[model samples]
Target: MVNWNSLRDELEQAKQEGRYRPLTVWESRSGTWMTLNGRRLLQMSSNNYLGLTDHPDLKEAAIRAIEQYGVGSGSVRTITGTLDIHDRLEQELAQFKGTEAALVFQSGFTTNQGVLSSILGPDDVVISDELNHASIIDGIRLTKAHRKIFAHKDMDQLEAVLKESAGFKKRVVVTDGVFSMDGDIAPLPNIVELAEKYDAFVYVDDAHASGVLGKNGKGSTDHFGLHGRVHIQVGTLSKAVGAVGGYVACGQVLKDYLIHKARPFLFSTSQTPAVAATCLAAIQVLKQSDELIKKLWANASYFRSKVQELGFDTGGSETPIVPVIVGDPAKTMRFSDLLLEEGIFAQGIVYPTVAMDKGRVRFIVTAGHTQEDLDFALNALERAGKQLGLLG
Candidate 1:
């Protein structure tokens, strides 16, 4: 009756093909350097870009919130969900993003899903980036919108798509402000101009850029000097902020629409009170201090420079997420394993995460990583590359 054996066969094939992504348990802290499998290693794998995940302010705020409001929010925001902390965090995010309103979601993925699905329907057109995050792809799939994906950051292709979007009920140009894997910026000024020319709405998922780009990590909109023009700016507290939630900053009317129409936002339980408070604290740090963000950029620059000098192609990366494009999944895995043994935790990214033959060893640098830490990781990577026949 059940095809359990067939499913098992599929898994076996994937494992044999070197596509298995086994989770490795780490016995350590959420800091720049960590312990994995009983070995202390440099952690260059997390999305904690601004190093705020373990900040005293955020931790203390979460602790205070737990003490006062207990652990969970107990219900969906539509019911008894919106706690006091949620309201405060929303306010802070709205202010930070220069938006009239903002709404929080359970995670960045859900946030993207909510925004795309709620605003677009059949007959609507969604012009998306070819390499936008998987969550955005799924969100577009959920909508009834006709989707057209242009080449990554190729404004010409985007404009061509917009030119051809004349028959839809509405058109929305969606993109990731910072390409998560490529670490390059979206050609926003061109995209924004094209949207205006085509009378289309603009949406940006700033998951990777929220606390890495722009002044004090205000995000890509601010980075590009186009503050209020973008209709939706979706961000996650899970990345640079190091908390656990998502939000969409937009006009009051748009936020109102999502509150009523977005199923994920309406049905999902509120973020834990502790999470909301920690997010607020993280935003406060971003708003008031640039020290950590500065450190993050410094670390990124140093690491990128070293990687390039080592003759590893980083693939147009302009941020902390660096990709060592290793072509074959097996080679990528071998490179990762070699680095793992040498105490660097950069992982191999292959297949579904990226297209076939584009497998890479994706490295992430953090604000907390010291020069010494970066040097250690670089040395390990050099040896790994040599051992894997990837370099001199």
Candidate 2:
């Protein structure tokens, strides 16, 4: 057998650098709450923004799908794998997004992989946001395109890159609608204007925004009110929608291209019927119910105000995702441990995920958390911060 000692050395190096995340196994999860090692705790770490993971409607849909269609699709979408549920989900997604067509992939990761690899070649240029998601970075790298990264949320730098790369066969400007780490909205209007000026294609990964920001939780495009300006809108059922899989909403031409050329969509097994069926139900809930969204924003606003009033830096956050910035990685991890002890379950995010010396304890709020829950979590946070010398 080939020696794998070098891989162990790299893993050790990652651990030493405070970048290796040994994820804590969760025993179970409820609405904005979870159990770990048999301890029930308030969950501020999950991305289930609407608390839809175990939603009654969503659960029932999944249960029915499991009973009717069985567990897995068991084949790639190209090979008798596109089930009726998958087709319905795609059609419904296209309608919901106000786009001509849509294509579902195994996940948001594979969505990027499909689109990037299909549309880009050696002569093309992909101008990406510096702080875009890791999946986007990997997808761009996989393509033969020349990847150019602009400063995080910097329109001037983006335009500069587009201008400098004068004669590429094609150009694509990619960005995250809501940056997952920092929780700030991207300047899509400016990006759209630049794309028009340079004849560049536009792509936005709205993973974090899909069920949190837009009208009836439509997403960042809806938040910014730039409906037709974006060439492609990539989103996930995993994050805010509280399900599995991902999709890209774009024009018929783009969808057609992806269907014929994207390797991930061609090779990967389609989403399970239960997952697709549940996701469709979740979207219906999003479209019809504003009550949950209102509560979600209300809770987020309250938490932000309380946390800020208590004197912790939240790092430019304007949404439910709040980060208590901790300069050192060890201290950030300690902060998380302390929060867990206090019965709050927020997690620490460290480098190389964020910049060096900018580790943070990131807390995600949802409609599921009530006023009393927020207050309880806030109280625990204050105690932990004071004990860690984060708040004076």
Give me the overall lDDT of model 2. 0.90
Name the weakest run of 10 consecutive residues (lDDT summed) in model 2.
14-23
Give the alpha carbon lDDT tens digit for every residue of 7-100 in model 2. 9999898777666768688888656677889988999888888889988999999999999999999898888888989989999999888889
The runs of at least 3 residues in candidate 2 whose Cα sits more than 4 Å from the true structure, single-residue gaps closed, are 1-4, 13-21
Instruction: Estimate every model's Cα lDDT from 0 to 1.
Output: 0.90, 0.90
- TM-score (all chains, Cα) for each model: 0.98, 0.97
Q: What is the lDDT for 258 in model 2?
A: 92
Candidate 2, residue 300: the lDDT equals: 91
Checking candidate 1 for backbone clashes, the offending pairs are none
Where does candidate 1 have its weakest 10-residue lDDT segment? Answer: 14-23
